[model samples]
Target chain A: MANSNLPRRIIKETQRLLSEPAPGISASPSEENMRYFNVMILGPAQSPYEGGVFKLELFLPEEYPMAAPKVRFLTKIYHPNIDKLGRICLDILKDKWSPALQIRTVLLSVLPYCLLSPDYLIFSIQALLSAPNPDDPLSDNVAKHWKANEAEAVETAKEWTRLYASGA
Target chain B: MARKGKEDYYSDAGGDDDYEDYYSKGEDDVCQSDTDDENSGSDDGGGGGVSDGDDQQAMETTDDIEPKDREKEYDFETEDDVRRCQDEVTAKTSELLSVPPGFAAAFLRHCRWDAERLENEWFSDERRVRGAVGLAAAGRDGDVPTALNDRPLICAICFGGYAPGEMRSAGCAHYYCHECWRGYIHAAVGDGSRCLLLRCPDPRCTAPLVRELVDEAAADEDRARYATFVVRSYVEEGTSKYVRWCPGPGCTLAVRSRPGSRLYEVPCACKHVFCFRCGEEAHRPASCDTAGAWVVKNRSDGETSEWVLTNTKHCPECRRAIEKNQGCNHMTCSAPCGHQFCWLCLGSWKEHSGGNYHCNRYAADKSEFTGEKTRREQAKASPERYLHFYERWATHGQSMTKARQDLDALEGGGLDALADTFGVPPTELEFVTEAYAQIIEARRVLRWTYAYVYYQDPERHGRLEFYVFLQAMAEGAMEQLHKCAEGEKDALKVDVGDYGAVFPAGYAAGKLAEFRERLSHLSRVTRSHFTKLVEGFESGMAEIVL
Candidate 1:
């Protein structure tokens, strides 16, 4: 509440997300830093990512709405958009950032897109930077490995989720 | 009769056409015939046209032979009436039927002047006459036998020649190459000719093989050929739809006509054929519109709605919903009742029942229920309680009110207080924006009237009304909570549960826990869901917007 610009925006978004935080995801701010946060997403049960727990890290900059905040995966997982650094590849987190969009809307769009379907370019920075056409893929490795060998990828991700995110 | 050789089949054409791989099928093969010009087809495999058929047929032909007599028909003469006229070529053979009257030209045509077979044709004018007649019998321009059963017809599958005596007949009036026929019969199960069908060798012919002809007096080769025709017919569906038949080596069942051609729907028959097109064991409705063209036009837009739910009091076909809608018309509902009826005959089926009120009986008392309320308000006041009255409705086939009123009852509660009381996890609810606070506040005010009324009156029937009103508001509040979770997939400190595509069991459990956790900490449930919003997770939302 101290910072007029940042606090009001945070308060507003915080309220919206609490009211409805998507279908399978759970999220909260860290105790130490109100601006730094953690999230819990139930793996889209119908998708390959189902039954797994995923954690993410979000940090609001001094200038947030004007500039996109940085959100990254704290846990290593296989996805077309999120890279090794935990940085999310969503367009809203980049040059496409708009003032009209809020935290709740941005996060709402993320879950069903990431966990459900294979289309991550909408929320992925890497997918956009490399493979522009959804038809062709930038990380053809993931795309091919996922589309062709989906069962293997699903098993491996589940193993990783159980070993890491969903466990102690 | 020409010997059934690859070289001989192509000898009629005499040119090294690219289709050298596709040996022309002659009428001599029982199941097939020479491909008309329309079928100059090549396949990916070298025997593309009949790779599977050719290999299978070759094995079958080899298996049937007795080592004692290897009869190869070489120097046989064809019938004189069907002999060729010069210069006319049939598309089936792709060659001139007879020699031109000129000697020099006819000599050039056979390539007789070439090196190997003869040094020269000069002295033997008699050799020339012999060559002309030889070329004519090749069915180049001659009207060789086209009757499927009488002549050894070409097997449509293997493209091999069947010797005249080797051919047998079937119901569909088609023939099969003997080698192919033997394999076909061997592949099928049963002593009954039902497995065997005598069919035409012409490609794309929809005709089925006559079962009786093959069943009664078929040779071993003919029986096998008939079996193959029957099985392939089952797979083809429309003409010979296989509902479900045990493809065992010797099952003589023809249960294809059985209703519900499904895996478990297979009613045990002494005989059976599973129609592949419809899961029904027997005949499937051939067409959708043709079966009964009942279009479901949306009352509002006059546009056709896709949800064509047919109404039925009892399962029509099996009288069981268990097998309902299995096939096109004759819906074999999977219910134990075994209701088998046409979907069209059942009529239009709207959700016949409502919350504690069946539309049928509800329609009668509709005016009594809507005395003071508008339709939308009535819809909103669902989950209403009529504790004792509900017993009567239950007997009438109506559902009852549920325990959980709205999503808020499950999700948002005294969350902030409980979070402080239990010293538990901080607010995990994601945010959409506080801009909707006014709208939520307005709805909360709208919702409080029922709660206020419930508070003021303990015995009044109005108490149930207010409880239902609160449930509606709670539902809207829950909708907001789900909406925020959707946008935060890429945010920091993400949980594993946010990605449920279809609400799964695990997701439901996690969500319930999360909802309970949110309600425990908060004091007042807000229609805006602002109370459920925690101080944390906002940065992830902010990051996502970036």
Candidate 2:
């Protein structure tokens, strides 16, 4: 049985987020699902991912206390920590946790950060594809592409965004 | 294995015997000389260790200040009897329940000598006052020396003989074996609290246990005995006085008194006679023919605990040898207290074998006493009066806990969004005090935080307090957490490079979901709060960026 506070805490947190002046972004659980939420982030003006809103999916686990909720990207974007499948590797969302850390702080750090890092994408992703960084790399083809032809890598990334992201 | 916080209670009471006697007799020693001082100002009641230094010299100081007068000068009291040990273990243990009332209360009064007192008078030394710890080195005057011939290895607190391996040395140069000292201190602060009262084992010396010395000396003795000793400044709680048997061999007697009572009675195998308040063997409670064998039973279910029984040598733990009172076979011990209980209903408290302090912390919520109900009205009967008692008892500390939990709605996936988190179920109806306690707490905490917030941003601070006020009106204290969310996100950014302190329990539950779900649709970060919100973005995303 749901304790009466279940709906209450949820309503309080949502109203708390919406009425607050949180510039260019607002996120909340869809009206139907209490455990899942939809997020909206405005692109940074100085970044390549600018002028676009991005989205992601989050799943809270039963052992939420000892473990972090599993978060994944629903948007298709080119980034180092994010793969084509939208799998993200964040620490605060995983093992290195303290009892003090909470949800809103996680949003304040993770989403905007993934959009800010274009250098890590080139270095880590290039290393992942063309020729592995050996010490660090997620895929080999992009890494091989980076080491062999730098121009080709940028062109390929632009081409991928144009096609997959409707940039064309 | 014991009732909530009860194990230490009785075990501590065992150590309380002689200590309480010491303080009750303390006034007599001082009054013998300064008969006029008997009614001295209450402030002089327990003058911490005698640092009345030069004053003694002016009166001529050659250690003429007897060790027995130490409590009078310092007020490092012993309980008047076992029943009122002190705040440390009074409520949990039946030990105090067994002690006579008067002696225990006297000892308890002097136990909490505050830091202010410890500084201004206790340790000053300029006042010609000296404490009991200073005496082991400074020989006693003409009074009979308390040192027993060989000392028989008995614990000064419990009056029971100490096993060779179980003795604790205190700052006052006195000692109690492992069982008594460890049990006493443990009851004061659960276990390993480093609690310190450091007084003489003779029961009345008021001094620190020179704890540093015991640490230095622990090398040659049994590790367990060393564990028994401790020294700290916090007052002991829990070991309130209860009448108890003197641990003295062949003495086999009990006292009926508490800490502050002026009169006390002691029971002996033949005819018990003793004054616990005055520490004199004057009058006894039991008559000649009505004593001898003491059979103490441990009954998990009973009214008014029984720690000592006369005329029959029964073990305190097993009423098997005892003709029990309305007892049944539902016994148990859960953790360290090893208290017995009815296996099925889990109710009742009982006495354990010699010196064991096992007992229960609850009473059965359902009362079966029905002698007056013979003329029962079957058509319409009233509901039981104690029905709500157990519920209230069970949720005792729930409101103050502030424990926020995350329950995953993953099995069937009907949860639409993570905006809502669950609050604990209130144990009572809407009108109960617990529901309001949360509101009161929220308002109080908001008040304290208001000054700190105002210093950070005066305008934002005023607005924030008003926001919290709205939350209080809407819900209660815990719901007040919702009010801090926006401000918290703002605060998290300013200190992101050092954002370690701002984390709360549900940080990831909402933040991560919002960040990830929203980031999927975003290709830019042009928002203002975006800078503030991103304080944790890099580190937080680092976990999922793999």
Candidate 3:
């Protein structure tokens, strides 16, 4: 397998992710590049995008755990924090990133279920959907809409999810 | 005290050699004698005794006197001085707060180097201050477990197994491998001065990665950079309002203005003079606001708008700018608008046809020309007025630059050439150096005076006129002095090969002496004129204004 020369950390994390995937989350390494992963995260239960399956492309740079992993949405989803270019505005991906944070903690694991201590905060995709911080927004128009009338904004997000993230 | 005429001054001082000797004694003597004339009633007596036995006594007295105001206003500080200042502050804070120097430095930085504020907050609520500044709690200072366990442990960062000796942790015992710690510190250091505020790699840990940790883990160059940032933060963020980094490019020196004095102009050791208040080049006659506004106006495209207003006429219909290249009165704007109008009246061209070309004559109504036409005229006049002051300001700036270049040339090799031609040593030509320096100083004053005058309320009639008169007088004297220093020096140069026949024994000496006298006399006149100009401006020409 192309994963032969991968770091032990990456190999262990991939094995764990495949064997015991987080609820509503699935991630597997791509065939060609072990550092590249194909991830599918189902929206949280009560969110507007609950029935939607959001695909994301996550790449572990050479800096790996020292730097945050580069993740972006592959499927089009309407969210205040996600811009039209699929770039997410999350703290861990930027100046707040720490060397100790792992891909699972960044993408999927819930606070209680995370193997890392409960205090090790996880800004998982589901958590981000569950609480979209419109204050620190990447998409200005969506944030304005969300601020002006959140219910209508949520309806528009649901419509977008139905159209673009139907898991066809 | 009687003012000495140019001729009387030179003649009274005696021959060229004697006058040169008088000047070479130094400028301090001239200032001393001037001040003595004002204070002591021994004017003529002291003046006469300047070349005699009293000269030594005068020199000795001048040496004891210092310009007290200048000495108190500002001081130039080197890099070491700034570092010493930082160390003193850090030590005092550390002693008072009962904390390590690293923590003290961090607290000072958090409080913007305000030691008093840090003390206030620390004493008010130590725990809150500690939390805010990312310092560990008091009792947990030495509670970091020794990383000497026998069993291997996994580094959460790299997920690698290492013996306890290879691992490191901050007060919060979240261990990371040495390699991972080094990499993290290196990355943070690369980010910039903010690296000084870096925390531990544990996402949840609030333990600040202090300077000691950085010094131990950072690479050689990164460590040096981090050290630089630490030192700079003290000066740049310190609570001391008096000290400021010299704004000169690549200059590492800092200037400390006096605590209560309002003196804003400071000259650095590098010879770059700047206004301490605004960080701009020293502009004396103009206030900082006027100079700043002038500089901004010069840099912005306001002049381009003015030029467009003067050079091009806007199409009456579309308002697109159109320039008339042809001589015909009928004008056609190009492309889409294609509006046709008379160039003079800016009326429809059809009205001018059938020999009804009366647009040249004044309209009897006069109301048609009042509003827009008058406004355009006023707008055109405004740019012309700005250009008048701007051109003179720019011209003086260019003259100053040229004079500086001349001074540099004289210092470099021109002095030697003049000496060779004049049959004297290079040291004898110091008058030329002094002349160029005076010209440069005068040029700078004159340049900023234009900016000052441009901002003066034009409604104040006699004050501005008197200022202009003073400025003109100074400019005239400066021109004469500049001519003597630049053109006349070249006139003294003769071919070296024709040295023997062209001049006899006393001829070169006589010519050199004459040139020296003219140059020195002009220099003094120019200096006095500019001094008067500055004093007049400083006094706000209030005598005339009243």
> Backbone clashes in each candidate structure, one number apiece?
152, 182, 0
lDDT for each residue of candidate 2 in B297-334, tens digit (9 for 90 to 100): 11212121132222111222322223222112223332
Docking quality of model 2: it rates as: incorrect
The lDDT leader among the candidates is: 3
TM-score of predicted model 1? 0.22
List candidate 1 segments past 4 Å from native: A1-5, A119-140, B1-546
**For candidate 2, what is the lDDT?**
0.32
User: Candidate 3, B65: how far from true, in Å?
Assistant: 13
Stretch of 10 with least lDDT, candidate 2 chain B: B288-297
Residue B489 local lDDT, model 2: 30
Shift of residue B387 alpha carbon in model 2, Å? 75
Shift in Å, residue B284, candidate 1: 80
Predicted candidate 1 versus true structure: per-residue lDDT over B400-480, tens digit per residue: 012112222223453343333323443433121121222223232222222222222235566445444544555466444
Q: Please tell me which predicted candidate would have the highest DockQ against the true structure.
A: 3
Second chain alone, TM-score for each candidate: 0.19, 0.21, 0.65
Higher-ranked by DockQ: 2 or 3: 3
TM-score of each: 0.22, 0.22, 0.68
Compute the interface RMSD for candidate 3.
Answer: 25.5
What would the per-residue lDDT of candidate 1 be over residues A49-71, giving only the tens digit for each residue? 55666777777775554345677
